[model samples]
Target: MSFDIVERSLNDGTPVELYTFTRSAQVFRYTSADEDVLYQGATFTAVPLSRPSFEQSQDPGRKPISLKASSGLGFVQQYIASPPTDSISLIIRRFHTEDNTTEAVISWMGRVTNVKFESNQVEIQCEPIFTSMKRPGLRRLYQTTCPHLLYGPECKFSKPTFQLDAAVNITGGTTLTAASIGGEADGFYTGGMVEWTNAGVIDKRFILTHTGSGITINLPFEGMVNGDSVRIFPGCDHVLSTCVDKFSNEVNYGGFPFIPTKNPFSGTPIF
Candidate 1:
């Protein structure tokens, strides 16, 4: 029977939901059923997961949805303990169990925005993808510091060209000791980034400080230990001097180095 007909009938169908969460190359699938479900040749593991009612809006604004899951679930610890640097997108599908061949319809699509813990459940808040399209774009700022994001298209600089190879010799909470990290000046990599593979996933963190062979990161990767290989990249302070000397890309510098410090319009600024 067709899905619409079965869905409209009160006692003719058993409906189930499938939730898929994705980030970069990682994908997690869950099924709202007693046992695992196989659809489209992929397995969606059954979990204690439920979503509140969500609606589509005619207005050009954000329509968010929330997913509540059992805290005891192992996957719940990931969001609670350490949120990923990249955004995680979600796709929900609904189909009737009465017909195995019937295709599931997409019920909702969004990206996870925040996670909250309540007693024994975790609530994941998500915002619709359309909301991002409705937001304003970036505007150029009249400031001394370059407003272009590092490694972004506007910066016109290649990140891999300045990347360095290193290995962890020791690790503290959010600090790591690596001999290669000290190859340059103390603050050469202060605003730079570091990344390593953890459990087959690429984990990244920003350098908070760099001194000698010790460097602190904004966050520590789970299970990071000594002997792990890591990639480090040098940072730019966004100054014209640094751009010319360090990166040799002053031609693409985005800041005005000679902006007047003293305003001539001020009453005492005639000299």
Candidate 2:
């Protein structure tokens, strides 16, 4: 035999309704004075009232019963409704103020349409709207070592990569275009492609000013378009190198670069 139970705690003078199932052989338990009794589960039908409260007269269709308490109190009223089905619907409403003004009377409705008795789960559906606004420059974006937004000791990964898509604009300093976009895990400087002039390489920098916007540096690579994306691949044992800032200036490896060999068995071999 299996059963389900729902318990609600209320402050003094709060009105509530108790709905239950019939075949389950349920029970009602309450202890508190100054409590106004409404419907009792003596019979499997709706009970009549001489002078109904505001909540009772509102819902005349589903025939919901009510209980009103005066002082701080608690009560439990249990009764049987219908048998279990794949879905059930519940509606809830609220008032805006204590005066019960027609203009000030705000009501809300919510429904719990589904329940899984075996798993002790429920699904509630509702429609409500809320909004908020804020000024610019109030938010700062940071890329952390973990996808879970963890930092410092909590971050287990050795190196984390972050990419900026837009062309960073600065006011005063020179423009430092990256050979490749993205910052290293441990290095102070970010690496980017610089123009190879006959004399030497020219470095770029950016400095902010009150009158003008930031400076912009254009990259020379074909695929490295403006606003193009970049990614950081963290170091992993047997996967990524753990040298951290070791590759900051090193672009190509090995003094003598090796070229790929052609397939020897591609054409017919001479005897």
What tens digits encode model 2's per-residue C-alpha lDDT throughout 9-125?
232224333222211232222222124333322321222211133344444433332323222211111001212221222222221111122111123222222222222222222
State which candidate has the highest TM-score: 1
TM-score of each: 0.92, 0.15
Candidate 1 residue-wise lDDT at 220: 77
* Superposition error at 172 for model 2 (Å): 39
Scored against the true structure, residue 181 in model 2 reaches a CA lDDT of: 30
The total number of steric clashes, by the backbone 3 Å criterion, in model 1 comes to: 0
Q: Predict model 1's lDDT versus the native.
A: 0.82
Segments of candidate 1 deviating more than 4 angstroms: 56-62, 269-271
